[model samples]
Target chain A: MTVSPTRIPEATVARLPVYLRALNSLLDSDVRSCSSEELATAAGVNSAKLRKDLSHLGSYGTRGVGYDVEYLRYQISREIGLTQDWPVVIVGIGNLGHALANYSGFSSRGFRTVALLDADDSRTGELVAGLKIRSFDELTAIVHEHGVAIGVIATPAAAAQAVADQMVSAGIRSILNFAPMVLSVPDGVDVRMVDLSSELQILAYHEQRKSTLQPDDGVVA
Target chain B: MTVSPTRIPEATVARLPVYLRALNSLLDSDVRSCSSEELATAAGVNSAKLRKDLSHLGSYGTRGVGYDVEYLRYQISREIGLTQDWPVVIVGIGNLGHALANYSGFSSRGFRTVALLDADDSRTGELVAGLKIRSFDELTAIVHEHGVAIGVIATPAAAAQAVADQMVSAGIRSILNFAPMVLSVPDGVDVRMVDLSSELQILAYHEQRKSTLQPDDGVVA
Candidate 1:
């Protein structure tokens, strides 16, 4: 059965990589198959939602036997485009950018960091994770050289939009922005933000709720 | 109007910070008021969804004036518990930890980095963003001294779970994990993960779709 990639909802698409990670962990543990309940637990989602997400990829595990771990992993990997190596360029060799450049998870999965570019001339020759920090002027050359489609922006918020504009003009369409700003990109481009402050704020919201519900717990500071 | 925080759904709770950031940007730009559509555009969400989300906080703007930027900002901030400073401890002083420690967005928004703790003895006394890196054993003292409730784990994947255990023992209840592994915490403790690689994977999924739909675009490498 063929599942159209366009038909998968955004939410389901977001969850596929998570499911793939869970499946990979299972494979590492020498597990061959697992039930929806087990896979869902590994993915930190409920079984019903997990089943629904998998169904979107035309992957319905056998009723009693559960899913074939390797097979499902391949399906999700293909669906998420992880089967092909995605050449990625990291702009801005700041602390966050340095961390991202050193992050082994990307290469361990399917992302290949082809180049690290920075606007500051002083940082141009700096080596981060074995890759020399190139000049921002070299973005177009690097993108075309590596056939890069994805760009990671770890520059400060002030520089985020400008870096994004460069990435767009260089023919990159997918962006993972770590800057604490809202990036305005064209319709065809997809920008996903991973804001540290925003995540902390969300945690604070839940933390506040816990205190409100148990006022006498005396956990408040 | 008093809105009960408990009633807001998890999905809506996650988006409140984004809305708050958008409102802050508007406020910074001297925008006095904005309709649902304008705020939604700033937040990168549709107007209906933005309206529904704001309604959960009882923030229905005037019929014509839309939302008062300052007032709605305060409401969302208070709702997300950003009204008061949250004392946070960051465990790990690696590249990612350094970036997080230097992240100005957190302090600007309401979270104060009270202490930076790491298990590496050599790292102790090193200054990051003006805060001296302390030994991991100081976790308890720092948490109690600062009345800290949120802990951030930027340690390597191998050390994440152990750090989480120490944080839990030190009475920290909320965690924002940046490690590339799954963390298992007991009930009453909240954990949110920020996976950089996973975000790229999701982008690759959509990028793959675009290529599939427009094969003649010659975007594929």
Candidate 2:
């Protein structure tokens, strides 16, 4: 029921949410139990890997009866600290920022966007997902007011690092960056980069390999 | 110079793009040469891991003199197949899709958005990123006309699986999915998920640990 955060491997920590999502879908369908193979299929991972990842949190499915879906879901959620409310601030109100503001998953998963901050003065007072956009200058006040611990940066590359520096100064520890730049933060501050361009390039890398291997195939009209 | 795709590990394949980005930044600054330590810092990896990864591609930097920035950049680019053009299709013209269409990284890094498709008829005439939105029915024709091998699904969760199925049927072998759902695909098709909510959850997990470890340390005024 209790596992220290340090005990779980980083890769396993990343997949915890995926397992949580799979368990949520199972719960919605009124499924009370599931075998490791079934859960693994839902999570898009091999059953052996899934079992190993779950073992880190002391969750082992029964020999023949499998896991109790709701129980496992709660255990994983608690281990991931989803049981507590996490106040967040999103900076930069560009297209990606709009998408993040409208994302319903955050609210459903214990994250509440306390403020949407943008450096542009014109963006202030604009409404997004029921929260009014505020100026970036107000970040310190907003973070203090809402006790925001996590920040999201959807700014362009040129402005990402400055925004991250401000977030750190404002006492924000976790950053979910959408910019296509590498951000440097002090140790203990976690920065997760969701580079859209890099992801596409990765897919392109594999696609190229496939085409080279079968140069004559799929020559469509 | 020709290394088979199967020879590279999946983790290394993902990091290659990051290395390419770092090298690009160096190239922009007229950095003709760099030590492994410097390149690894820019790429946000340790020098040992960077050296090991580059070794897999038969690239071993000269002792003391380090690597030629341009040469290493080209090598990584060629290895990742960034020298070629890759046509891509984006399905769903919502906020996230609009963001993807406007994203400059894709076009700059070998991915060309051939078409934008939407299920709603009303979105057909709307122009996004200089390309007019088209009906989802035109997917097959667009895929064939452009020989698009990669697809991006930004539709809502309920529609993501159907869109993926359509992409697969239309001959798309790789998919970058933004919808918050588990997509089931056939053997040959590759699916990469960019779940925004899940990313936030991971950050929250770490943030929670940070707060618990230092409770009452930052009770800001």
lDDT of each: 0.90, 0.89
lDDT (0-100) at residue A108 of candidate 1? 90
Q: Judge the docking of candidate 1 as incorrect, acceptable, medium or high.
A: medium
TM-score of model 2 (CA atoms): 0.94
Question: Once superposed on the true structure, which residue ranges of model 1 sit more than 4 Å away at CA?
Answer: A1-5, A215-221, B1-5, B215-221
User: Evaluated with lDDT, which candidate comes out highest?
Assistant: 1
Residue-wise C-alpha lDDT for candidate 1, range B98-188, written one tens digit per residue: 9999999989988999999989989899999999999999899999999998999999998999999999998989999999878889888
Find the candidate with the highest TM-score and give its number: 1
Tell me, per candidate, how large a share of the native contacts it keeps: 0.89, 0.72
Candidate number with greatest DockQ: 1
Model 1 Cα lDDT, one tens digit per residue, A1-221:
66654578888888887888788889989999999999999988999999988988888999899999999999889888888989999998889998999999999988999999989988888888999889999999999999998999999999999999999999999999999999999878899999889889989988987878775664432
**Model 1 — TM-score against the truth?**
0.95
**lDDT tens string, model 2, B1-221?**
55543468879989999999899899898999999999999999999999989988888899989999999988888888888888999999888999999999999988899999999988897999999999999999999999998999999999999999999999999999999999999876778898898888888777777766665554211
Model 2 chain A: which ten-residue window has the lowest total lDDT? A212-221
Clash count, one per candidate? 0, 0
